[model samples]
Target: MFRVQKLLVFEFEAIYEPVLVEGPVVLVDAQGNGLRQYHMALTSRNVVFSCDNLFKNSTRRGPSDEPSWEGRGQDPEIECLELVSLVPLECLRFNFYRRGDRCLMMLSAHQAHQHLNVKEPMIFEFGGHNFKHHFWYTWRERVASIRVVQPRYSEITGSSPFSSSDVQLEEELTVQVQVHPRPIRSSSGIFVRCYSSSGEGY
Candidate 1:
């Protein structure tokens, strides 16, 4: 009984050792209809999606001290794995949201074929409050590291930048007008107007 329990524990650890997050993901359409279902495993190097067979061929032998069962005598050299899609480390865009107890992550890149893309993004749904929090911080740091700087010519020329609507006259001038009173037939009235070439008028 002790040997049997030890063998089972060893097999479990080996299968999940390299996985960061493993859960069911659904590829949905524009109308939010599920197009397909896949079991996904997120590792540091790749996002592996498996269909039909998951962990079916992951059986291996334990240590020599642990007695093996009848079928577990020799370790198999070749194993069968069926994968639907495998996304590489160049996943450019990452977006995620939490709905109730499940979390959904969307991964996309410059080209749709390089990463997972659909009419509606593939919704990676997983449970557990702590796992959701951990996934958020890990991916947020990755996305934040890529900084895109927009070129500004003003910075190189050492001048303040202004918009088209913010333009103003380069210089200002003051004009002085002297008004002299002149006598008319009944009432005396005189008005003097002055203009300056610098754009000031009186």
Candidate 2:
């Protein structure tokens, strides 16, 4: 029984490790209808996304640890895109969006990993507020949270998933998202994984 418990624990750890979804984060409008989605996979130096297959209907919890060689995974046809403009050793700024009772999040700019195309920069936004600690610290901290959110624009109500509406941004909510890697940092803390950038997260 003890050995069986140990085995079960190992399997549980494998299945529900500390990680976000490798699946699309589904998003519905305020009325809750057929909505859009965004698949985000963050790394230490880069935040990647699968651009080939957007607006999927699936909503998975945690990422799968199964080896892809076995021919089973979510969005196998997904085309990976690297927002190759992040330096995990710098400060990442944050912005909050709120309208009365409705609150949202949008994060922009990085102090360290700034490699974005000047013409088209990607803004990371979340659907809600209250989780500022997830991104409000240096990357070298003992643990950091990587959150995935579906952006709901105020003007657009169940329109194109990627519609560019007039953005009403608010005051800056700053967060120290990166720092110099320390020698004594624990290996068991938060780790990120994305295509081409594997191993413990930044």
Candidate 3:
């Protein structure tokens, strides 16, 4: 059988690493009871935010037909929000290890602020001391984008898998944004790790 197959392809036309303005920030989704983590990866061109909400266990009728929420059958929901456009803000990081306290600073409010909501106190342990702090996002940094997928429709009198007349080429570059949030801060500026999981610095 000789027939045409609607094999289409699409990929990132171009990708550029963003400048290190301030980064590896870990924000928590205050809107959710679970308080999911939203990691921040800052670049000159964009600020990529990603999160993974993997439920350890899901409730489902198991082999015994009994409902179970103890690591049964389900996968965690994952998503990412990227801003092609970006803006520089008055971002600051501080760590009082000796005092056992820390603080977060973001002069320009963006969507990441929701996770680090300043309205409520974010209390935790830092520098071996219990610390409590608040954050506020005056503005939400969001960019609008649309994605669509469809079968490639074309007409060819005779098309087969053996046909070599036409060819579709594709190139891919998988960028795994590595996020690292250091608890300690220095007097100079942002505290970036030297040996990250990827062993590559941006």
Candidate 4:
């Protein structure tokens, strides 16, 4: 059975202009042999931001193997991350703000998922501001347990004017879940709701 107990939140400000950013976001537990694999599904709101300008990249290091590249400047392992087939969100929005003549963009109602081989540590990076606000279950019958590490937030300077000073927030509670591996389940739904300290849900 898979049970959820902890939830992690990572919030940070974008300081650089939109560029190709890539890295791992989650780490998968590799059984014993010291081998690891990672997977990620990415989606974004259809705002003016250029999707082409955004890129996802990954690098894996094993005990004996040199670091391998997943995308760009490549060694070829077909680095393209697979996108899962599912119902798209009904609506999407991008919130924008200005501070001292600089434009800041925030993704609203944005969600994504990553699947990794359960035999390796998972690490990832993103090109833009990635806000995690929900979790979508695809293979509900195959998962036996689920745990989320509370995400931490930090701002990258020279990207935007938004700072940690612009907002006040609290540490999010972690979520852990236990579930049955089989029973023919479809569509297990979970969403993250974020609110400001002032009681405003964003």
Highest TM-score among the candidates is held by which one?
A: 1
What TM-score number comes out for model 3?
Answer: 0.24
Which lDDT tens digits does candidate 1 get at residues 1-202? Answer: 1121122123332222244444445555434455565555544444556544324444435433433233644333212224455555444335555454444555444353432333233444443345544444343332333221213211211111122332221232322212222212332233222111110110
For model 2, the superposed segments whose C-alpha errors exceed 4 Å read: 1-37, 41-48, 51-91, 100-102, 111-114, 118-202
- TM-score for candidate 4, please give it: 0.20
Query: Candidate 1 regions off by >4 Å?
Result: 1-17, 53-81, 100-102, 112-120, 127-202
Compared with the true structure, all predictions reach lDDT values of: 0.37, 0.29, 0.24, 0.22
Model 4, residue 18: C-alpha shift (Å):
19
- Which model is ahead, 2 or 3, in terms of lDDT? 2
Q: Per-residue lDDT for 120 in model 2? A: 20
Candidate 3 C-alpha lDDT tens digits along 5-94: 000001121332322322223332222122323334334223333333232233444555544345433221211122222222212111
How high is each candidate's TM-score?
A: 0.37, 0.27, 0.24, 0.20
* Ranking of predictions according to TM-score: 1, 2, 3, 4
Ranking of candidates on lDDT, top first: 1, 2, 3, 4
lDDT (C-alpha) at residue 122 in model 2: 26
The parts of candidate 4 lying over 4 Å away from their true place are 1-61, 69-89, 110-202
TM-score of 2: 0.27
Q: Enumerate clash totals for all models, in the order shown.
A: 0, 6, 7, 45
True-structure lDDT of candidate 4: 0.22
